[model samples]
Target: MTQHETPERGARLGRACGADGSGTAVGGAVVLLPGRPGMPLLSPGPVRALVRELARAGGPDGLATHVVQHADGCPERAVDEVVRRYGDVPVCLAGYGSGGLTALRGGGHPAVNSVLALAPCLPDEKASAPPEPVKHLAGRQVLIVHGTNDGRADPESSFRLAARAKKANRSTCRFEVHSDGHRLREHRSEVVALAVDFVLGSVMGGRWSRPVTDALAAPPPLGLRMPLASGFGRSLRG
Candidate 1:
């Protein structure tokens, strides 16, 4: 456990289960935006596991974790709150499903070092289609991690996000396709490991883009031997 610093101004504070109570400021400050409204910040179990895993792997000293719980369609509101609190020091948006939509939209902030959107939900009704927020993430360091077998947001969404990001002058955008579902329960540990490595590398080393041969290379999850199709989805929303 470490100590907490009450910034001189702008602080949106809230707590949930598994919040990494060490109170110590690890590698810079990180603002973790959970799922949108109606969806809890820490989704009960597996997602919490994912978070804990990231916090553990993030660094040797451990990083600070803050969760933003806002309503649906109010990601902008949460983004403002995050700006108020963290104030441009490498904000990490960790959202799932539509929450990922919220995270990407929040990227306009200058302090945002990178984004980790998992199974990001596109505004499109079609599962295979990309979301509307894909266009808003230009010039930002974004890592779209999706599951090949995802049923909710579809596996191709990551591809769409990556393609749009790449086209938008952000060549460093990364996409990690895994072999799991919307929740990524099968590769929970690997997900966090990637998240930690990416965040640390981005903040300290300014490295966010993952090396990829082809945008749609089929690979296993992070570490597991699960046969899966991994690649950036096609951008359908423009």
Candidate 2:
């Protein structure tokens, strides 16, 4: 794994990536939230690869990235720190497992233009409590990528969340990695490529592909159950 320098200020750092140093015109930043509140910067294989790949794909521009080692026990709160760190740039909040739910919760932040959830693991409602909030996502884009064969988090639950999110924000869309597991090991390349596309488009601003656009307009489960093929980086984008 490669090493990164820590900025002098803002949020406890983990892998401050790309043009984090002065004089680099950072157009946007993608903050990665791990499944847990904190972990060693690059210990987790998936998180490591994500930060590396996204940064590499983004090149040395406005696509700087950082990992939140400790979310103050709240991913939503972590976003506020991210905004302070990135300054004047659109932010894409992405998370894994339960952290994905955290990213969804944090999407309401004004600086966040988009939210991405990978194998989100949401907790069961208390039955007395209200459902997850979707209203706050009104203008922001949201994408949920779940593995159909995920053993940890129920894929259906994410679909339900996506449906509500889609209703609140017509820009919401989802993709299912057929037969993949929680780690999404089987299609890591495709998943990372697709994620890079989504985050970059959301941060730098770009049009969605026809399939994504169609899903955005499709009803209920149709949009929430869109398939993510092995070559989706190219095929789905078309």
Best by lDDT: 2
RMSD of each candidate relative to the true structure: 8.1, 4.4
The lDDT values for all models are 0.54, 0.75
- Residue 101 local lDDT, model 1: 73
Q: Candidates' TM-scores? A: 0.69, 0.86
Model 2 alpha-carbon drift over 4 Å, by segment: 1-7, 43-45, 234-238
- Cα lDDT of model 1 by residue, 75-137, tens digit: 455445444543434556667777777777776665566676777776654768554555555
Worst 10 residues of 1 by lDDT: 229-238
lDDT of 2 by residue, 68-101 (tens): 8545445555566555555567888888887788
Supply the TM-score for candidate 2: 0.86
How far is 168's C-alpha from truth in model 2 (Å)? 1.1
